[model samples]
Target: MSRHEALNPDDHRDLRIQERRDAALGDARMVCIVVPAEFRALQAEYPILFRLNETRDRFSALAMFGFENGENLYLADGRWDARYRPLAIDIQPFLIGGRPDEDGPKQIHVDVDSPRIATGDEGVRVFDKHGRPTPYLERVIEQIGELDHGFRESGDFFAALQRHELLEPFTLEVTLEDRSDNRLVGYHIIDEARLNSLSGTALAELQAAGHLEPIYMAMASLSQFSALIARRNRRAARG
Candidate 1:
């Protein structure tokens, strides 16, 4: 298939999901997926989604395939890069199902990679400890974005897999790979959401199956329900 054809339009996203899962399971390559808050409501209605996550409050969500490739993929804003690898994964729960604290707006914090020092505010070439613009490092920097105190960003891996927390189970890893004499650093966060939604017997089935911990349960459902109304307009225009 042509590269563009390889990607599924938003409407056929489910088909692409199955294809990726099948490929990962068949190849035994370690794969991770994240979902966004926009789709969390779908999981609530269909409890089946929780089967994919690797931990609680974090949504790695695809352990069954057991595909052991270390490379990470990122998808967001309708773009996908199948080759970016994250060096670190961080998680912040939205504080759902708990007493409210007057700290700030409820949200989750997902951070990937370590902070990098920039030459100046404009941000120039990424330099090595020896002051060299490493090509691979540049690509990594561009793909992952420059890291700094003000730029708290998580790669799209967590965002894409946010929806999948309802369907898969998996784990997070912090890894460093050595290419030549330098080190490439990265990490991930993962889990399934069912552990948080089940109650009494229905909940026991998942727990007995070694699936417990609901990442979604910790975070309140999206309060701005009207945003979905905006999505309807886009869908209508497409139609």
Candidate 2:
């Protein structure tokens, strides 16, 4: 139930997008799609995980927002608490659309139904009076491009992981402050043990091929779950 349309600067010049976080503004996502380019930044703030998309037939990188579905711990009081907000969330209602013309450049489409978009001036401006994309919109366009490249690279990265037999199933078992167990399953994480067991030549090749750093980043991100658990405990205490 999304109303998406190819953004026309002329017609949508007056459109606005709120800068703050709000579940009602379509930011209530438990997981946000991330490209390999964001792994370093997001790893510091979130536990990066790989998710399979059956329809796309591709493995995608995701930033874990909360331990449970439909829960975004980063979103509290209409503000994003994380210092590093993933570009996937920043892109908002704007998504990549097919080419505007047969051989012309691709178009950025916006969802009119998204609560982020409005007629009144409140947050980020989509266009200026001259009918040109505003600076904020321009940055969003750039991020969309970054995401596109990241997706392509991620496919190859995942393939490398598969080839090395490094993708392993992970089940996170956490005992909250209430002594209730929260078991998160059905996701994959880098197998640090297996990765460390690789031969020197293989390790060299993987590093030269630009896969080693991200692997370690993923391994390091697991510790962030402590922060996630703390947030969950706080939420429970509130209730």
| Model 1 global lDDT (CA atoms, 0 to 1) | 0.28
Candidate 1 lDDT over residue span 1-239, tens digit each: 11112111232222211112112222223332323321233233221122323354543322111212542222223332222222212111001111222233222111111122122333223334454544533343333222221122222334434433433422322221221121211332233345345458855654453333333421322222123223323434555
Estimate the TM-score for candidate 2: 0.92
In model 1, the Cα lDDT at residue 232 comes to 28
Residue 119 lDDT, candidate 2, scale 0-100: 58
Residue 165 miss distance in model 1 (angstroms): 10
TM-scores for candidates 1 onward, in order: 0.21, 0.92
Candidate 2 CA-lDDT value: 0.83
- In model 1, the Cα lDDT at residue 89 comes to 21
Candidate 2 residue runs with Cα over 4 Å from true position: 54-57, 99-105
Worst 10 residues of 2 by lDDT: 98-107
